[model samples]
Target: MPETGSGRRTLPTVADTEAFGRELAADLRPGDLVILDGPLGAGKTALTRGIAAGLGVQGRVSSPTFIIARQHRAGDHPGAIPMVHVDAYRLGGDLDELDALDLDTDLNHAVVVVEWGLGVVEHLTDRHLRIQLHREPESDVRTIVWEWIS
Candidate 1:
């Protein structure tokens, strides 16, 4: 069962993180927004890889830090869901700059996942699912916490 209040997941390994992502993906739908916040090396991308796998998206899923964003098209298959993965680590101080990214265009048919978007991107919509990852020091364990916002 999902943890009360926070819906937390204690992921001890890379595979566990991915599995959590996939489990979350099962409930995602078009136009849904998932915001992720965590320090470097917190397994955000690893978790996203699992989400993509759950969505039935083909191709490699990696951090798009350089490109800003990457779209994974859902192939012709049952239960396929498109994914728009974005890295907001490079954006400037202005939230207005996010408008240029054009993420809203396809959001209606895909799940938009934003990394490091704690403050800038949440204003895009009133309803969203936010995930935070915290890595344990001196250990590979990571804690994942998620909650719904409206």
Candidate 2:
């Protein structure tokens, strides 16, 4: 089993982070909400990129910081679903401005990955997977904690 942030397990490299993401992706479904919390350069986008790959989404998976969000459609697989990636870093204060963007309407059909998502977007759904990334001080390592709440 993978360790949470409170545990001693550490992520030594970028590939480990991506691999952990792929493992987590196996449990995802449409309408699933993922909230990612981390500081700058903590590999939030890297994990999302791994998720996109796991979901069979082709093309590049880049940060949507400037554009707010980006959608990636699954290819080849008939039952594949879509993914909605959102960046909440730019939305200061409350998420009213972010909510005004009408992302709730798209929540039904795609897997939503919200970066810098903490208190702002947690109320969007009662059920969600919250991932917290922490950087280690002694080394270039990271610790990711995934919590499934319903």
Candidate 3:
């Protein structure tokens, strides 16, 4: 879990994608923003589920597409950070809609993960972990490339 700066991984299954997320979560903390960029069926929500597990947050982790966002409270652990999972695809590049989510405020106490958040949510923080998941053609494999942008 050392900050090696950046790395990429190939996941052959959905479980592998989530496990990779758990490993990545070891390096995360409150006030951290993680932007997941990818197309449909890229396993972004699955990855977030792993992150939520690693963070010990309570609640069922699922895609927030319909509601746009979902908040998962931290479990019984003292000082555990909460999680706010958001789907920015529906925003349609609307800054006003993005601002309404008030993600910056959530960053004060939770780990914010946004699917399809690449260009839209970067302004919420000066630094963020950007992970891109790309599904291979005609296969279940996914390639994840991640880096910390400051």
Candidate 4:
């Protein structure tokens, strides 16, 4: 695993990547944004699953590609905030369409995680944690890079 700059971690397997997401969720606050960057099958959704677990969300966690956005409320975990998972793969050239979804309503009281969010929704906020996942050649391994930008 390779890392650039400071405070970044590389995960070796899908489970590790998800575990990292859980750890990250523990440190997230209301209004926190997470942008996931990766090609197809790079385990972006798997990471989000970890995030939901960390946030004390129950039930199953799946990619909301067809629905655009899905909200999950915190369960037994104390002080746990809501989790808003967004799949930007279907988004067109403009983000206005996303704005129309009323995602902003939960922006201040939930943690928003967007997959395929590289250029489309990167500007939604000034502060966010960017997670980039890449695959290793000829292996089931993946390299995950995390950066906190404010």
Relative to the true structure, candidate 3 reaches a TM of 0.95
TM-score, every prediction: 0.93, 0.88, 0.95, 0.89
Candidate 1 C-alpha lDDT tens digits along 1-150: 232235887999999999988888888888888889999999999999988998888789999999989999996899899999999999854566789888777687899999988887887776888899999998779999899888
- For 6-96, candidate 3 gives per-residue lDDT tens digits of 8889999999999998888888899999999998999999999999988889999999999999999999987556899999999989999
- Superior by lDDT: candidate 1 or candidate 4: 1
Off by over 4 Å in 4: 1-6
Cα lDDT of model 4 by residue, 1-150, tens digit: 112232656677888978987887778777888889999888899999999888887668899999988888878768777899999888864578888866667778888899988777766777778889887776658888788776
lDDT of 3: 0.91
Worst 10 residues of 2 by lDDT: 1-10
Q: Give the TM-score of candidate 4.
A: 0.89
- Choose 2 or 3, whichever is better by TM-score: 3
Clashing pairs in 4: none
Q: Model 3 Cα displacement at 138 (Å)?
A: 2.9
Clashes of each: 0, 0, 0, 0
Instruction: Kindly report which residue pairs in candidate 3 clash with one another.
Output: none
Model 2 scores a C-alpha lDDT of 0.79
Candidate with top TM-score is 3
Native RMSD of candidate 3 (Å): 1.2
